[model samples]
Structures are given as C-alpha cells and as structure tokens.
Target: MTGFDPDWWCDGAALRGREYLSISRDGVELARAELDPQSTDVDEYTGLDLPATVVKIEFFEVRKQLRGRGVGRWAVAALIQHYEGPWFTVAAVTAAGFWTSIGWTEARHAARPCSSTARYLFNANALPSLDHGSDL
Candidate 1:
C-alpha cells in the first residue's frame, strides 16, 4: 500500500483540482496515480504553481507483487482514456524506464547529484524519447 502524505504532497500549491485514480484488485490497491490539473515547477525543482494545462501524474506506485504483470500499464491506459486534458506529465525516479517504454517522453533536465532520486518528465503529445533502453 502507498503511504498517504498529504503534507508532502501539498507543501505548496492548491490541491482542490487534483484527482487521484486508484487501481485495485481483490481488495488490494496495486497501483495509483494522481491527476493534477495544475502542474508543478520543472526547472526550479520546487512544488509550486501550475505549469499551464499540463496534467501531472503525481504519486504513482505499483505493489511489488503486481510488478511486471502489466497491471501498471492497464492502470495508466485507463487513466489516459479517462483524462480529458490534452497533455499529461509525470515525474519518476526509478520507474522512469517503465513510463518511457509506454510512450511517455522525457522532459530532460541537468543531472543533479544532490540526492539519490533521479527526476524524469514525460509528455502525452509525443512518444517517449528514452536515453537508454528499458532495463528497469
């Protein structure tokens, strides 16, 4: 189960427009992602303000038992189908490859070694431009 951190999620910006979509089976929440109408800052790397019409896929996670079962893909596809917005974005660290393989392009930024987290961005309008092949 994914931990709910409303404080970390709402350190800044308005959360009223955010909608969370969950994928569950047999009473288990295997995967989930948030549909945020207002996108956060990309360049500055701070959770503040909307980045235009970008629908940010915030806080996505798939359970370990459900990994590699394609359930994650199905969940994302469902979200895409239901989403009315034109563009979507997501920021991932370890799961960047998985998202890229599903056709979400990377919004490149200078590699900052400040923390163990590796940030990646994806757009809905174009196929993902992966710097490396899918291995994760």
Candidate 2:
C-alpha cells in the first residue's frame, strides 16, 4: 500500500477562496480536490455550526479507472498531512463507508440524520496523521 507516490499541485484561490488541488503520480493525474476554510456562521444544508477551525473539502475524486488502487489512500493521507483539525466535508450517503474506513468520524446528528448529505471529520490523528500507506 505504500508504493503510490503522489505529487500535488495547488493553485488559484479564486474559487470562493478555495484552492484547487491535483494529485499525480509520475506525470499521470490520479485525483483532484478542493479545499476552503469555512467562513460562514453555519452550514446551510444541516444547520450545523461552522467554526474557524473547520477546513471544508469542496471536492474530492479519484480517476474512475483508479478507484480501488491506493490512489485514494495516498491522496487522503497527503491531505491530512497538509491541514489542521478538523477536516469537514458533505459527502454522498453512499460514500460514507470510505470516510469511516479511513478513520473519519461522522458529525451528523440524529436531528439531521436523513439530510441529503452526510458530514464527516478527520482531526489529523492527534498529530501523526497517516503513517505511510499502512495507516491509510
């Protein structure tokens, strides 16, 4: 699982102050993501409070043909290393497993359990984040 070598390129803080990210391996693009610091007072979808500490993930995707490989793992690991606690994202309900499997804890409460999107958080693992590919 440790073999995927990811190179990240980030630029342009124009998308609502979010930065675009691209991850590649040996010149081949493997994944893409967008990150923004949450500035709003509350989440419109779930009405959850948004604090300055939350870093919102605007987008995340791995190439279709590279789904099951370690590409996603490496990308997520890289992100955790670059950010502080805690990460926040509104994800499709179906993809909840991926978040949980990677040590993300759900932030959705019973009051908003059936919302169209689910919220998840990753707190940089107390400091170490992911250890190579094994933890990812």
**lDDT, each prediction:** 0.60, 0.63
lDDT by residue (1-136, candidate 2, tens digit) is: 3233233223333465776777777888788887776634234434344455566676677887788876776888777666654545545456778888877767755566676667776666445534465432
List where candidate 1 sits over 4 angstroms from the true fold: 1-15, 25-28, 40-51, 109-136
RMSD (Å) of each candidate, 1 decimal: 8.2, 6.7
| Top-scoring candidate (TM-score) | 2
Clash pairs detected, candidate 2: none
